[model samples]
Target: MELRLEKFTKRFGDTTVIKDMDLTVGSGEMIALLGPSGCGKSTTLFAVCGIHKMNGGTLHFGDRDVTTVPAQERSVGVVFQNYALYPHMTVEQNIGFPLKIQKLGKAAIRKEVERLSELVQIGELLDRRPAQLSGGQQQRVALARAMIRKPDVLLLDEPLANLDAKLRLEMRSEIRRIQRETGITAILVTHDQVEAMSMCDRIALMKDGKIVQLDTPEQMYSNPRSQFVAGFLGNPPISFLPATAGAEVVLANGQSIARPRDLQASGDLILGIRPEHFGPQHGEGLQGEVIFVEPQGREELIDVRLDGGGDIRSILSAGAPIRQGDRVNWGVATDSILAFAPNGVRV
Candidate 1:
């Protein structure tokens, strides 16, 4: 089902938490509400699932307005961070709990539970209780439970946050696969950038109770609309240097990084360079002294302090002979550079 939030606003007493937020989630497409804690991503999820009442605006599930729908009547399934399962109930019971509440026949409930268990690859564990399952297994049970009702929309609130690193990685792929197979319009609320980028078709990056950017993960990373969006999406994080734009884009240290043709605007600007964009340069380039080096199997993260001033980071092959305190010259990919105004707006 397609989900739409128009001018959705929420407030707690006097302070507003969600401010006239508008989002359209296409049918069968998964979207992520991604941002730091207290950024209102969770608030938006609660509002969508009918857990929280909206202070203003309208919400729709497809063409039907559900602004006042009760949580249990919304046809929305929620998988929480803690995988809220009944400790004493067996996996089969837990998975079919929704159906049991509706008083389905025992045989029918058992068949539906079996089908969902197999879909989530937890059929063998159906006889096991929640306490007997591993973190990943418990998660699977929660997913199966959420889907047994065949909800039109699924809300996952940091469903993988409790798992170990290995399990988190595994579950990421598993969730994406299950989402595709189920074809439910899903919304994931998470602070993990990797989770959002890897699983969701599109990301709604939220900040200050509003969406700062809503786009595909690839586009959100490659073509960020603001510095915060760019900085929030990268792994090692993009480096920023204060610079002035005139005849050339010159760093505070007086190193000319790019020409007029490389920039979209002039005057005071900030240059953003991804760590991988810095490469060995024999000629005109930024000269810096290595200040820190971290080895990561196949590559090294090198931090450099410009000769005159400022600092930046670079990702280089492990074989690179550079070391801490060593002076080096690195050239940035001019075309890939991102220019921004001091106010964080993209130039």
Candidate 2:
């Protein structure tokens, strides 16, 4: 089912947590509401699930206006971060609890429970209790419970946050697979950039009670509309250096880099570069002294202090014979350089 929120607003007391926002989630496409904590991602997810009332605007599930509908009637399934499994009940009972409440026949509930358990690959554990299962198993149970109803929408609230690193990775793929196989419209709320980028078709990067950028993970990373969007999406994060914009962009350290012809902005600007964009100098480029080095498997992260002032980080091959205190010349890929205004807007 397609979900739409028009001019959505949410407030608590005198403070507004979610401003007037509009969003449309396409049928069978999973979109992520991604942002730092306290950025209204959770608030938006709760509103979508009908847990919180919207202060203004309307919400729609397909063609039905569900703005004032109760959560139970919204036909949305929610999987929480903690799994929220019933410790006393066996897996079969837990999975069929919703059907039991709806007065489903015993034989029908048993058949449905078996089908969902196999779908989530927890069929062998049907007799086990939540306490007897691993975190990953418990998560699978939660997913099965949410899907037993075959809801119109699925809302995942950091469903893998409690799992170990290995389990989190495993579940990321599992959730994506299940979501695809089910073909249900879904929304994932997560602060983990990797989770959002890897699982969702598009990411709604939120900040300050509003969406900062809405785009596919690739576009959000490579063609960020603002400095914040660029800095937020990268692994090691993009480096920013204050510089003067003129015929040639002059770095704080007195080095002049040829400004891109498309950049006609004047006055103070910030140069943004990713760590991977810096490479060993072939001839002319920035000069600096290696200040720190850290090994990351096949790659090495190196921090360099510019000759005059300022500092930048670069990722290099672990085999590179560079060490702390060594003077090095590194060139940045011209096409990868991004110029932003002093106010953090891309130039």
Candidate 3:
């Protein structure tokens, strides 16, 4: 089912949480609502599930308008951050609770519960209580419960936040596989950029109660529409340096780079470069003093202090013989650098 929110607006008391936000989740496409805390990503998820009433605008499930539907009537299933399992009930009971609420027969509910347990690979734990299972096992049970009803839409709110790093990675793959196999329209609300980039087809990045940019992970990373999106998407986040733009764009250290023709009447511009973009310094390259080097298995993160007095980070292969206090020359491809205007929009 395709979910659509048009001109959606929500408020708490007097403060608005979502303001004229418009977004559409295509049928059977898994999309993520990604942003930092208090950015209204969670609130938007609830709004779609009909847990929070919109102050204005309309919501649709395909062509049917559900703007004022009650939460219980939406046929939406949710898995929250905490897993929210019942300690007193066995895994079978927990997964069957939704079927019981729908008034399914005892035999039918039991059969469906067994099927869901096997689907999530929790069949062996059906007799155990929530306390007896590992965190990852408990999360699988929760996911099974959410899927038991064959919901029209599946909403996951930071569903992996409570697990350890190793388990989170494991579950990320499992969740994506399950979503693909089921072909259910899924909306994941998360603040982890790597999770969003890895699990979903597209990402809707929100900030200050608005959808700032919506696009695929590759587009958002390779060609950010604004400085905020560029800075927020990468780890060891994209570095910036001040530069003067004109006939010859001059870096802080007086090295000139070819100005992009798309930059309209550039005066003062911010040069954005990813750490991985810097390569071995060739002749006429920018000069910097290496300050630190960190080995990250396959790659090394090298910190450099530019001759012009600013610090930037660069990534090199682990085999590179670069070290601290070593004078190194590094070069960046012109196309790899992004220029942003004073107002934070990309040039």
Model 1 ranges with Cα > 4 A deviation: 260-262, 281-284
lDDT of each: 0.92, 0.91, 0.90
Candidate closest to the true structure, highest TM-score: 1
Q: What is the lDDT of candidate 1?
A: 0.92
> Model 3 Cα displacement at 296 (Å)?
1.1
lDDT top scorer: 1
Candidate 3 per-residue lDDT, tens place, 1-347, comes to 99999999999999988899999999999999999999999999999998889999999998889999898888888998999998999999999999999999999999999888888999889999999999999999999998999988899999999999999999999999999999999999999999999999999999999988999999999999999999999987888888899897888767776775566757888888888776674233668899999999998999998887777788877989987899987777666788998788898
Q: Tens digit of lDDT per residue, candidate 1, span 24-128?
A: 999999999999899999999999999999999999999889999898888899999999999989888899999999899999999999999989999899888
Error of 3 at 1 (Å): 0.2
Instruction: Record all residue pairs in model 3 with backbone atoms less than 3 Å apart, i.e. clashing.
Output: none
Report the lDDT of model 1 for residue 57: 99
| Ranking of all candidate structures by their TM-score, best first | 1, 2, 3
Instruction: Give candidate 3 regions above 4 Å deviation.
Output: 260-265, 281-284
Worst 10 residues of 1 by lDDT: 276-285
Q: Candidate 2, residues 13-95: lDDT per residue as tens digits?
A: 99999889989999999999999999999999999999999999899999999999999888888999998998899999999
Positional deviation of residue 117's Cα in model 1 after best superposition, in angstroms: 0.3
